[model samples]
Each structure stands twice: as structure tokens, then as C-alpha cells.
Target: MSQMVRRLNDEIESTANMCVRNGKVELLKKVAREFRVEQKSFLEHLEELEDHIYLCFLTINRSRRLVVRLGHTRSPKHQFTLQELNMFYPTSKRIEDPGGT
Candidate 1:
């Protein structure tokens, strides 16, 4: 697993974001070639490794970046009635088909 992680660190273009660590198909093939494994197997391993690494960073960053609820807020209480939604339709066409049927 350390070897795979090392290989990934070497292969990745950037260290700033996990999006870069998620395997591109071409990149995965290249890693597979290096490991002499079938691309499908290598890709599965890559995904698992990336998930583990990403989760580690997420855990580390969570406390520093955590958002706190600052104030009391309530969900919107207003509900739109059917008539309110009918403003877009022409009032002259009252047959209820709206589709002009």
C-alpha cells in the first residue's frame, strides 16, 4: 500500500487537491503498466487508495474548516398556491388544457 501511495504521489501532477488523485483512465493505465497488473485491477486499487488518502485529509481539515451555525433560522413557511403559479399562463385560455388542446 505504501508503494502504491508512493507511486501515486510520483504520478500525480498536483498535491493541492484530491481531484487530481482520482485516477484518469490514461493515468491509471500508466500506473498499471508500471505495476504489471491488469488495468481493471489497478484501477480498483487506485480508487481505494485515493479514498483512504482523501478521507485522511478530510478528517485533518474538518476541525479547521468546520462551519458553525451562527444564528437561529427557520425553513420558509410560505407555500405557493396553484393560482400563484398560474401567472405564467394566459388568462384568456381558460379551457384548462394550457397545451391548447
Candidate 2:
């Protein structure tokens, strides 16, 4: 299991590296379309990913790779504070409700 997860993480990091070479917003669009992930969903991952790569990590889903961030960002909402990505962004489970998972 650990081996599989490590491989999945590797794929994600590589994909993210390619995206970064492009622009964050542009890459966000590309990843969403290619991966079938929502735009906001991808953005939340970026929000979690720090400008630096220190926090980038990978996880495997089924046989696919997913890169996640270790850092947290402030919510540009009506206020600013440390926020979780899943909290502000919509996930596969709850589309767009911060309150839901």
C-alpha cells in the first residue's frame, strides 16, 4: 500500500511541476479539464500548496496520483484567517458547501 501511494504521489508532483511552469491560473484551468476536477477545487489545492515546494506531497487514489499541500492560506472571503482547503472549496463529495465535506 505504501509503495502504491508513493507512486501516486510522484505522479502528482510531476504534473504539478509542469503546471507551475505555465501559470497558476492557466494550469488550474488545464488540470480541471484534464482531470475532470472543478476549477475551484483545483484552486483550493493550489491555495493549500505554498509558493514553495516544501509542503507538496502526493497521495494515490485508485491508481491515480494526487498532489496535496502542507501549507494553509488565508480566506479572501469577507475576512482573512487560516483556512482549510476542503472548508472553503467544493469537493467531490459536497460540490460547494464549506460546511460539508
Estimate candidate 2's alpha-carbon lDDT, on a 0 to 1 scale.
0.51
Q: Determine the C-alpha RMSD for candidate 2 after optimal superposition of all C-alphas.
A: 19.8
Q: Model 1 off-target regions past 4 Å?
A: 1-37, 65-101
Q: Please provide, for model 2 over 1-101, each residue's C-alpha lDDT reduced to its tens digit, 9 standing for 90 to 100.
A: 34655897799887887778876768766765786756577557755554333423322231132112333233334342223334443355434545654
Name the weakest run of 10 consecutive residues (lDDT summed) in model 2: 59-68
Per-candidate TM equals: 0.29, 0.26
Residue 65 lDDT in candidate 1 = 42
Q: Write the per-residue lDDT of candidate 1 for residues 1-101, one digit (tens) a residue.
A: 67967786675635323443674556655654776767578779779888998988876565334321111232356554445335433577423535554
Query: Which residue segments of model 2 deviate by more than 4 Å?
Result: 29-101
User: For each candidate, what is the lDDT?
Assistant: 0.56, 0.51
